[model samples]
Target: MKKRWLCLFVENEVGVLARITGLFSAKAYNLNSLTVGTTQDETASRVTISLFSDDQLFEQIKKQLNRMVEVFKVIDYTDIDIYRKEIMFLKILKCTENDRTFLFQFSEVYGIRILDFNKDSVLIESIKAEEENNLMLQLLYKRLDNPVEIVRGGSVAVEAV
Candidate 1:
């Protein structure tokens, strides 16, 4: 199976997001990432979804989404030139001075930001491609022994102009 992406333009109405996600759940499609936000039109929303599936399954998913009344358009992004990013906030607890210095150096090298810090904890933010964020998380896990908290804002994408 290969990764696929879809951008769905749908009516911005109550239950629209639920209905769309429900479709995936009902069909047992595994979603890798999903993000939704209102478009400039305000009356509509753009939903970005990423999943891993075979070509046939991906085609079927697009067809099913197109059949939804709320969906105005379903753009397949599988082979498109697009800019995509995922935001993640990682907090490290019980950080020592050396640990914080190490984290700052790591962040500088990776283009991550040190968002905030206190005496014992530091919060950092990473906005990058999903795969890059995943790799950062893996490296952090290997380096940090303190309690860690992570929150990721799924992914958003726009077609390259």
Candidate 2:
């Protein structure tokens, strides 16, 4: 199986998302990530979905998606031109003089922003998923006295060419 990303342009209507998701579920296709929001054009919305499936199944998915009434367009971004990014946040263990120094160094290197902070934890946000994971790993290596938690947002994408 291969990972694939699709950007679906659909009519702004109720039940559209549910219908689309239902189709995937009925077909036994697992959606890795899905993000939907209104597009600049008020009449339409864009849904970005990531899934792992074979080439034949993916083509069938696309064909079925197009048959839906609310669907305007379905673009297979994995094969076409696109730029993608995933967002993530981590709540690190309690801060200390040493932890603060490590935070500063890691944040500076990865361009992470401090979303929230307290004596017990610091929430750091990053747009790059891999970078965020790497930062979390590095912080864990230092071993703070407190525990840490990670939260990730879905991937977003746009055509690059």
Candidate 3:
């Protein structure tokens, strides 16, 4: 199935989120990720949601969303133009005197900053979510001999067209 990202503009009111999510549940659509926050316009809020489905079903969902009284705008970012990004943090196995230089070199190449460090692990932050995935893959292949943890933030999107 194809993944679609959408930005929904809706009125700021109680149960607004529940009503929106209900529509998807009633249709048996699985939501991959959802983030809702107040927009600069105080009267309205923006919701960013991602889901996987076919074109036809997605169209039906869009139409139903429009019928909701709270929905002000439903922008299918996957259609016209959009930018989507995610965030992740990597916790590498603690640094050793022997591996400190190697860690620094790797971090420099990837432009990753150390968010926290201890003898047993180091926390690195990457703004580019895809890059983090690639980095993890590379580390696995290289057998860095270090433990790692990843914390991922869901995808956020903005309309471009």
Best-matching candidate per TM-score: 1
Considering summed lDDT, which 10 consecutive residues are worst modelled in model 3? 128-137
- Superposed model 3: Cα runs more than 4 Å off: 93-101, 129-142
What's the TM-score of every candidate structure? 0.96, 0.87, 0.81
* 1 versus 3: better TM-score goes to: 1
Cα error, candidate 3, residue 138 (Å): 5.6
Q: Report the lDDT tens digits of candidate 3 across residue range 17-115.
A: 999999999889999888788999998999988999999999998899999999999888876677666677777775675565666677788677778
Task: Please report, in order, the local distance difference test score of every candidate based on alpha carbons.
Answer: 0.95, 0.83, 0.80
Given candidate 1, what's the lDDT at residue 18? 94
Higher-lDDT candidate among 2 and 3?
Answer: 2
Better of 1 and 2 by TM-score: 1
Tens-digit per-residue lDDT, 1-161, candidate 1: 99999999999999999999999999999999999999999999999999999999998899999999999999999898999999999999999998899999999999999999988999999999999999998998899899999999989999999
Tell me, by lDDT, which candidate is best: 1
- Backbone steric clashes in candidate 3, count: 2
RMSD to native, candidate 3: 2.7
Give me the displacement of residue 91 in model 3, in angstroms: 2.4
Candidates 1 and 3 compared by lDDT, better number = 1
